[model samples]
Target chain A: AQKVTQAQTEISVVEKEDVTLDCVYETRDTTYYLFWYKQPPSGELVFLIRRNSFDEQNEISGRYSWNFQKSTSSFNFTITASQVVDSAVYFCALTPPIYNQGGKLIFGQGTELSVKP
Target chain B: EPEVTQTPSHQVTQMGQEVILRCVPISNHLYFYWYRQILGQKVEFLVSFYNNEISEKSEIFDDQFSVERPDGSNFTLKIRSTKLEDSAMYFCASSVTGIYNEQFFGPGTRLTVL
Candidate 1:
């Protein structure tokens, strides 16, 4: 079984500040995919990034970056110079390599981020 | 940009009534899924379908839940009976292949059971 945990239930940050959301996963499989999704107030899931187990390199997309560390079983997402629009509930999900057989994602409880001006 | 779409943004129904949630996955995508999130809870997976059959499902996807790709473009989830506990935001998603692919999501259908 695969499980994902996001310990931070809620976070508040001022505009232009940086924030990092922590995610930890447990999976016995050697290969898997990690995902970060954002659900805004309108309740739509937005795909952020997907990182596979073999790719431990940190990724940066504009102001968004992700750190994948296999040793700690953690995939952390960071937002630099965040704006108010970034306020939303962020979720971390895990999918095993043999997805067709057991592809259902194990999702974290999600972290609600509130960005104040 | 291509996206998965779901219909009937909100549906209200009485207990024991049957309801079907609809989705149109992105063209060329091969795998589809249904998930639910109760108020103030983590999203829960219900079922995944591919090649016109269920590939995987969770315990919550019991006998009452069924998924069908009735035509080439539409994927539907039917609930045999509605329960108060069944009220939640039902999301439909699709992926190009399998585990390695990103699952694109629809805006979701908010089902309200009365």
Candidate 2:
């Protein structure tokens, strides 16, 4: 079984503040991929980043960063100096290579982040 | 970059009616998929299609739901009988391959069963 859990349903932060969204995953497969997507008020999903299991390097892109830890089975995302436009529903996903064309993705419940200016 | 496209940003249909949602994937992509997200709920996978056939489906994808490519440029999802619970935002996605690739999604169609 492959599962991703996002315990925080909603979070609010003032503009320019930093926020970290937590993601915990459970999978029996040794090889897998992790992803983060953003869904704005428009209802369109935007792909943000993808990380493979072999890579545990913490990545930083612009004001966004991700931390992948195998020990904790966690992939956490951090937004530095978030702006109002950064407010969106963020989802954590896992893709295990064995099932369904090997392209199926298991998504978490998602965390709704609201940045107030 | 080319992105997947969907038709009718919003659709309103009565319960028990049949509805078809359409999608046009990126021209060079080979794998296609459909996913649905209900109000305040997590996005759920429905089905994946490749080689003009269904490669995989979730438990939610019942016999009432059918998918067809119809032509080289268009893919469609047909629901035999729409229920109130069928109301959701349906997203179409496509990937270059069906293995270990990122699947790009469309703007999605909001189906409202009244």
TM-score of 2: 0.97
lDDT values, one for every candidate: 0.93, 0.93
Per-residue lDDT over B8-111 for candidate 2, one digit per residue giving the tens place of the 0 to 100 score: 89999999999999999999999999999998899988999999999889999999999999999999999999999999999999988865778899999999
Off by over 4 Å in 2: A98-102
Candidate 2 C-alpha lDDT tens digits along A45-78: 9999999899999999999999999999999999
Q: List the residue pairs that clash in candidate 2.
A: none
lDDT tens string, model 1, B1-114?
999999999999999999999999999999899999999899999999988899989999999999999999999999999899999999999998868688999999999999
Q: What is the TM-score of chain B in candidate 1?
A: 0.99
Candidate 2 chain B: minimum summed lDDT over ten consecutive residues — where? Answer: B94-103
Q: Assess the local accuracy of residue A35 in candidate 2 as a C-alpha lDDT between 0 and 100.
A: 94
